[model samples]
Target chain A: MQLVDKDQVSKSLGGRLIRNNIMKFLFLLCTLVGLVVLVTLIVDTVLDGWNYLTWDFLTSFSSSRPENAGVYGAIIGSIWLMAVTAPVSIILSVGTAMYLEEYAPENRLTDFIKINISNLAGVPSVVFGLLGLTIFVRQLALGNSVLAAGLTLSLMILPVIVVSSQEAIRSVPSTVREASVGMGATKWQTVSRIILPAAIPGIITGIILALSRAIGETAPLVVLGVPVSLLVTPNSALDTFQALPMQIYNWVKMPQEEFQYLTAAGIIILLIILFLMNSVAIYIRNKFSKRY
Target chain B: MTDSQLKEDKNMGTEMGTEIGTEVKQADNASGIIESGQPVFQAKDFNLWYADNHALQNINLTFSENEISAIIGPSGCGKSTFIKALNRMVELVPIVRTEGHILYRGDNIFDKKMTVEELRTKVGMVFQNPNPFPKSIYDNVAYGARVHGIKKKKILDQIVEKSLRGAAIWDEVKDRLNQNAYGLSGGQQQRVCIARALAIEPDVILMDEPTSALDPISTTKIEDLIQQLSKDYSIVVVTHNMQQAARVSDKTAFFYQGYVVEHDDTSAIFENPKDKRTEDYVSGRFG
Candidate 1:
């Protein structure tokens, strides 16, 4: 044979091209599948709940009559829960991440700790609920109140926040760290000034996701014996509460057809609140991200 | 200096020692020259190990105050390691272990009482690649002083101006002080890094192949700046490019396989190196 087989090579190239085209089409389908389902669900809910969703539905509390029912108590109770959860979890998770990434020695122990932290993220939320029940509800005598429930949710998301924050901290370039340290700045100064600023976008993204998860979690609150529906809005962290997901879950369990419409309306409202919260977080992330 | 080297190499090392031994001739600090008699860094039989690998072996070199000293070496030859050791920047690597001493102003750099940050304050460093913090040009220059506790805006502005001027990039960046430093070209960014180092006013500035990443024109600008900065600060620069070392350094140290083959006046080292390896290296015989 000559140096190359021209006919066979062209045939193989054509076959490879067809295979790549087929794979490209398949990948597009994979990418759009999730978006397709999400849009379908939202459209169906909006169509079913459009008429029922109103200021009245948001202003009142649960009632025997579907038309008179609302999610005011649930909404306010969720707010109280998050208010307690956000600051406590953020401070704890970011501090842990900082210590692990910057100060911890590179050894078997730190690796073990890191692996366990990521594992904790995969642990069931109900287990955290039981932990909260033991520590906050029974032992600490906080009862089935907002503080106990919020802490339980915080615990559920702690591993997620810590792991993500650690990743953000790690993503900071070693070159920047060297430059800072080379300038005679202490380790703490380098971290606070250079690394934190560069990593802020990633850290903020982690916090936003964790907080959103905290807002929607029902299992931990359920394990803590949180009510399915609250007639009165919680005024403080020590008071009883119900989150949006728990409220929606309660409405779905109701037998009345009128309550079905109410459930869809409540979902829309929850989605709106989540949307608003994410918008603010995204804005902050964009502001800080531009510098790096 | 350690066991197993060529016998002729040891004799030349002691002969070179006499020149360094009598180099304590300059004492004044406010001006240039890296004057003799004041050894900013003296490595006496200094050896460094990264875990099991002997990275630098029995290094005996003296960098005088106010002089521009160049270390020329091939890859893995330990020039970078030696300069990093001068400021204890090598301590960042946890696996590193050292024997003997690299002294700065008569104090061993590894002395427990003297912290790394304190040593770094007196000895700033510029890396091979330009690395500017993700901040405004003004903020980048002012950062060293700011971290050291200079907060007043007026003083910071002055220091920033002085530093940029020192690095000779003030005219290019003066109008864009608020712009992000990453917006600058490679040469400008390197100058900003130099300015950032100058803000601290260190006694000795260690540069690891400062112009290896730049174009020829930019490299020339940096070489000129190095010569200019030598008037006030002692600088030890490591470069693989023989021409760069020849053009900028007053004294040249030739490193090969983790050992200094020769350390002598730049003219002598280039013209009549005693070691065959050095002569071969400078003559393009083999790196």
Candidate 2:
């Protein structure tokens, strides 16, 4: 055999080495950035408010004086908003998902609807707030109350809920449908009994995640003119409301150091609530997935 | 063996012809023993199409009340299509169309008076793969009964137990009725599907390669169960396994390229086939 050339071997080896080095560097850079962001958020939040996060701060009602103020009203408002939004959003979203995933035929109109839904998911939260201000708040005559805010947020998160629920319903095997239909069950019966039950875990997880996002939203509520402070909780749809994000917003704008501290404490509570919701969603997904 | 036996055999042949054209079979015992009366279904000049492709061509056959009739053919031979047509199941496919007369208990099943749902209740079908719903075993069997409006707990429990026993899986799954059916073995799941079908108490049961997805032992168990089940319900099975067809069926219909090459008693079809193609296929000459 002829002797191999040194230059050719070196060139091939060098090319491979350079390519691998570039890939490794890119991967490491991405990992570093991700880790840095995660650590920074956690460390900054802890350092900013850990000492002030107490039961008294959590349970006490809000006050005009920075030293005495708490997040009770905002917490209650957030709870009420979620309670109202969850059921309404789930009903509308799951129903739409079922119709689209199961019954809707392939057509241009459906395709248009699907594309618009994805676009709506990407639409800015503030834009939704603007729309709510003009439509639900003014035209529809619903004032800056929990009902108006809840409805606005429901529309904002509706796309996410529908998309996620559709994925869940679509994931159920077609064999299950055939089995039910072959057994002489009606279309409605099969959907309700077999398809709905199998898809419940997925739907619940999606609803929780979507609701968590809705709970954190502030711009739409502000645009809808939700109150900055309220001693008594709103009892009806027409009464004005103030939520967690609005409370945080209001406190952060104040010039006093005490109000700043209170805002940070509220931020901690908000993060904990989000973390809890995400964990519950993850648990449900794991539980249902194990059965399949 | 004897002169009297020879004469009886001749008489039986003539009697067989008159009975064959009329009554299909009725279940009697563990064997697929046909009682020469009571035809359950009759198909005359049946044809089917999936869009433009011709699937089944001029099929004429009869299924007895309590006998297992096996439809054996090569791939794409339309055995499954024919079975689906019997229950109007082919309608599920958007492009599927059929031109045929399938008479069930002397009623034209394709008539406006006969709804697909009503026809399905009288004739149940089991697919090739075992597909138990993502529910408890008891619920899997009880699903059909509940759809038909049986709600009392005691009544549902009785129906579930009876169906499981009929499908020959009661002894294995009875202790774990509350457990999810998806956790079971493939063979057990197939039996659960069979039990689900049986829960409706249909007059006829159609199985599409019910044992193809099973292990040898499981296949044997299902074969034995099929033989036992023929005592109460008529079974029309489509299988690729020749031995399964010969073992479980009293009558065998050999289909080739969407045509019925031969239809006769299982022994005759296997041992002394009237058609050369059937002889070649059964003797392993060609598919």
Candidate 2 yields a Cα-based lDDT of 0.86
Q: What range of 10 consecutive residues in model 2 chain A has the weakest lDDT sum? A: A283-292
The DockQ-based CAPRI class assigned to model 1 is medium
Report model 1's TM-score to 2 decimal places: 0.92
Q: Per-residue alpha-carbon lDDT of model 2 for A176-285, expressed as tens digits?
A: 88888887888899899989888888898989999999999989987888888888877876677679989999989998887877887888899999999999998888
Per-residue accuracy of model 1 over A1-292 as CA lDDT, tens digit each:
6989999998899889999999999999998999899999999999988898889988988776888988888888888998989988999999999999999988899999999999999999889989999999999999999989878888888899999999999888888899999988998999999999899888988998889888988888888889875677776788898777888888888999989998999899888888887887788788888543
Off by over 4 Å in 1: A290-292, B1-37
Taking the candidates in order, what DockQ does each have?
A: 0.53, 0.44
What tens-digit string does per-residue lDDT give for candidate 2 at B1-287?
69999999989976864354223222212243446457788988988889898988998998877878999988899999888888888777768888889899999999999988788888998999998998999999999999999999999999999999998899999999999998899999999999999999998999999999999778878888887887788889999988678777888999999889899877778878999999998877876
> Model 1 chain B — which ten-residue stretch has the worst lDDT?
B24-33
State each model's C-alpha RMSD to the native. 8.0, 8.8
Spell out the clash pairs found in candidate 2.
Answer: B25-B64
